[model samples]
Each structure stands twice: as structure tokens, then as C-alpha cells.
Target: MYRKILITTDGSAVSQHTACAGVKFAQQMGAEVLALFVAPDYQYPVYVEIIPPSYPSEEEYVAQMRRLGEEYMGKIMRSCAGANLQHACMTAFSDTAALKIVDVAEQEGCDLIFMGSHGRSGWGQLLLGSVTNKVLSHTTKPVLVHRLISEPASG
Candidate 1:
């Protein structure tokens, strides 16, 4: 029933795997897919009047993040190609990834958001805020969260 699906990735193995699955799902539904990678924006060091020599300039940071985004988007591209699915990919620089994801989905007119979650619980989840959780909290659209399940160890 989904006309378009937005699949997000962070370049992690779990997210990559989830993105591939999302592509296949989109294919099955005859829906177009938009793969998005959100890179963190450059942050200037605080409390220091003078910028540190070791810190990268804004141009350098953007170039580095663009390279990383391409690397991550490449995997999604291959998956879409293999699935024979209609797909497009983009990269955005935003420290608030959840907000960016929601905005992109809305702007692209995507009916579904498919993404991976580490599935942390208890204190861990509390300590490290989850983008998936934030997206869920913020968005009114339907979200399909794929929790990465560890494979059983071979004896």
C-alpha cells in the first residue's frame, strides 16, 4: 500500500543490512525508495577562544562527510539495483538526524519510514538516546523499525 518508502542508514553493518531488506520490501510493494544518509554537522570546539590546529575546517569536514555518505549510500544503491527497484539516494548534514529524516520523508512524500534500531534497553538506552526513538516520538507517519537480531553462535 506504500507508494514510497524512505530507508535510512548510518553506514553501520546492522543499518546496511536493514536498508537492503527495506529495498526488497519496497520492491515487493511496487514502491519507489529513497535512501538517506545523515552525516553529523561540524561542531566547533567550545570554551576555546582560538580554534584548535588539529580541528578540521568546515570545508574539510563537509568533504569528509560527503565521502562517508557516498560510501554508505553505495551499498543501498547496489541493493536497489539487485532488487530492480526504483530508488534514489541523498545525503544530508545535520546533527539532529531524527529531525532531518522526518523532514526528508515529508518532503519526498514517503508514506513509510524503514530504519534499523540497535534495540538497546534499560540504562543503555537511556544513556545513549536513540534516533529511532526520537523519530518515533516526533513523526506522525508510520515507521517500520527493524531490530537487529544477533545470529546464533555456531557450536
Candidate 2:
């Protein structure tokens, strides 16, 4: 019964796979999709800079991030276009994906959130942190996570 669905993508194979499901679901439900790509804040670098081989200027970094965002958004846009689904795209700067994702879903009044999940476990999960888990913990809305498999199952 979702009228609006928020889908997050990174242009990765996993996210691309996840996007297909989101688009198909939206098409079936007649729901509007909002595709979001949370990108790194190029204006601010958390890591120490050694200035290795001419580091890009703040403006340059911002522009680069924007270009990447555009390319990533393009994938979802094309999928939506092919499916003839009503959709829009958005990009935001954040090191914390969960915060930005949840914020956008709330702001856009989306009834559901769909994101591609890597399904990390144990040590890797602890070290890298799962964005899906973070969003699940923080958001009040329902989230549908599509776990991307590295390989097809051997029947």
C-alpha cells in the first residue's frame, strides 16, 4: 500500500540489481519512486591529507563527486524510463549514509525504503558497518533490503 517508495543506489552491481526490484515493485504498485545516492562530502575530508600528487581543490572535489552522482543516478533513471515508472532522483553529501537516507525518506514522505544490502557478517560487519542495519535501527518507516549475492546458487 505504498504510495511513494524511496530507493537508494550506488551504481554498483549490487545496487543496480536492487534497483531492478525496486522499479518492478513500483511499477506494479503504481507508486512513485525517489532514487537517492548519498555521496561523500568532498568539501570536507576526514582523513589526514598528505597532498599526494596534486590533491584536488575543494571545488574540483565537489565537481567530481557531482559527476559521479550524475552517472550513478543515470542508471536508475534509465531503469525507471524503461519501465515507464514515475520517478525522481536526488543526491546528498554525507559520510553517514543511514542519516541521509532516513532524512530523505522522511522529507519526501515516502511510505517505504528499498536499498541493496551486501549482507556483511561478523568481523567485516563490525569493521565496515552495515548501512542497511543503521537505517533499520534509525528509521521509523519500513525498509525493504535486497541482499545481493556474489554468485548464483548451485542448485
Candidate 3:
């Protein structure tokens, strides 16, 4: 019964897994998908001798992250198209992805949020501070969290 479904991706396996299901769900509901990729904000290192940062300037660094966002968004858009689902892609820079994701979902009037969880627990969860958990805590809209099953390491 969702009109708009927002899916967040970070090019991780878990995120992609979540997206695959999200697309199917959206398709079934005839809902439009909003594929959003949030890039981390770039921070320039303090100059020791003004050797010029590798990116040269803050503008260049931001541009690079934006490019990465676009690339990831394009990949998701292709999958959405394959499912015959109408979708749009968006990119944003934020220090905290969870907060930004929740804010975007509210601002865009999305009915549901589908995202992947890293499936961290106990000390891991406490130390890493899950984005999905934070988003769940903040958002008022429906959120579906998908976690990929961990596979045993190859010998």
C-alpha cells in the first residue's frame, strides 16, 4: 500500500540484497522507488607545509564523492528498470547517514524505507553504531530491514 518507497544503498552486498527485495515489493505495490546514496562529507587534512592536498581543494574532494554517488545510483537505477519499476536516484553528502536518511524520507514523503543491516550484535553493534538502527529509531514511516546471511570464509 505504499505510494513511494525509499531505498538506501552504499554499494555493499547487504544493501544490494535489501534493494533486490525492495524492488520486488515496490513493483508489487505499483509504487515509485527512490534510490538514495549518501556520501560521506569530505574533510581536508590540516596542512603541515602546504604541500596541497591530493584532491587540491575542498571543491575537488566534494566533486569526487558526488561522482561516486552518481555511479552507485546508476547501478541501482538499472536494477529498478529491469524490474519494470519507475524510479528516481538521488545523492547527498552527510556526516551521519542515518540522520540524513531519516530526514530525506520525511522530506520526500516516502511511505516506506527499505534498507540493509550489517547484522552487528552486542559489542559490535555498540561500537559500530548501526545506521539502520538509528534510522529505525528516528523515522516515523514504515522501515523494512534486510540483513544478508554471513557466509563462511573460503579456505
Candidate 4:
């Protein structure tokens, strides 16, 4: 019943797995896919401690993140080529990635969202702070979350 589906990815194994499910679902439903990757804003002062300030300027770091996001999103699209599904990719900056995904879904007029329960970083799940949970709480759209495994929370 969906005409447009939005799938979020981060080039992780779980993301690829999620994309596969999304692709099959989209194919069966006759829907086009919009693959999106929202790079978390990396300009905060906190990042100075995480990364060397001399390596890249704050602006350059954000740009690099966006570029990597696009490349990862593109990889997702390429992987779906065998399915012959119509698709597009987008990249945005947001510290709140779940909210950004929902925003993009609305902007793209997508009927459904498909994404991994956690991206490559795995920090989301590690902290019981899954992006899927945030999106589920914030949006009315249908979401399919792909989980890599069943694990108890670790403090």
C-alpha cells in the first residue's frame, strides 16, 4: 500500500540486512525507496576531545561526515540494484538522527520507514538508546526495525 518507502542505513552489516528486507518489501508493494543517512552533527566542542582539532577544522569534519554518509547511503542503493527497485539517496546533519529520519520521511512523503535497530556504531543499542525507539515514539508512520541479535542491557 506504500508508494514511497524510506530506508535509513549506515553501511553496517545490520544496515545492509535491514535494506534487504526493505528492498523486498518495497518490490512486493510496488513502492520506490528513499535511502537516507543523517550524519550526526560533529561540530560540538565535545568532539574536540574525541578528534584532533589540527587534523580537520570543525567545518571540514562536518563536511567529511556528510560525504561519508552519502557514500554509505549510495552503497545501500547499489546493493539493492539486483532487485531493480527505483530509489534515491539523501544526507542531512542532525544530532538527533531519529528525529531527522522522521523529518525526511515526512518531507519525502514516504508511507513507511525501514531501518536497522542500530547502525554501525552500535552505541545506540549499547545505551538502550536506539534510534528506532526514538522514531517510533515521535512519528505516526509505519517503521520496520531490523535487530541484529537479542542482548540484555549492559551497564
Best by TM-score: 1
Which digits, one per residue and each the tens of the lDDT, describe model 2 over residues 1-155? 99999998765655666787888988898898899888877654445565554678777887787788778778778888888888899878888988899999999999999986652244534422378889999999999887655632322
Error of 4 at 75 (Å): 3.2
Candidates in order, TM-scores: namely: 0.85, 0.81, 0.83, 0.79
For candidate 1, the 10 contiguous residues with the lowest summed lDDT are 119-128
Model 2: which ten-residue window has the lowest total lDDT? Answer: 119-128
Of 2 and 3, the candidate ranking higher by lDDT: 2
Residue 73 miss distance in model 3 (angstroms): 2.3
Q: TM-score of predicted model 3?
A: 0.83
lDDT of each: 0.83, 0.79, 0.77, 0.77
Candidates arranged by TM-score, highest first: 1, 3, 2, 4
Q: Per-residue error at 51 for model 2, in Å?
A: 6.2
Which residue pairs overlap in candidate 2's backbone?
A: none
Runs of candidate 3 with Cα error greater than 4 angstroms are: 48-53, 119-129, 150-155
lDDT of 3 at 136: 87
Write one digit per residue (lDDT tens) for candidate 1, span 45-99: 8955888898888999999988888898898888888888888898898888899
The digit string of per-residue lDDT tens for model 4 on 40-95 reads 67655665567654676777887788788777776667756767878888888888
Report how far off residue 54 is in candidate 1 (Å): 3.5
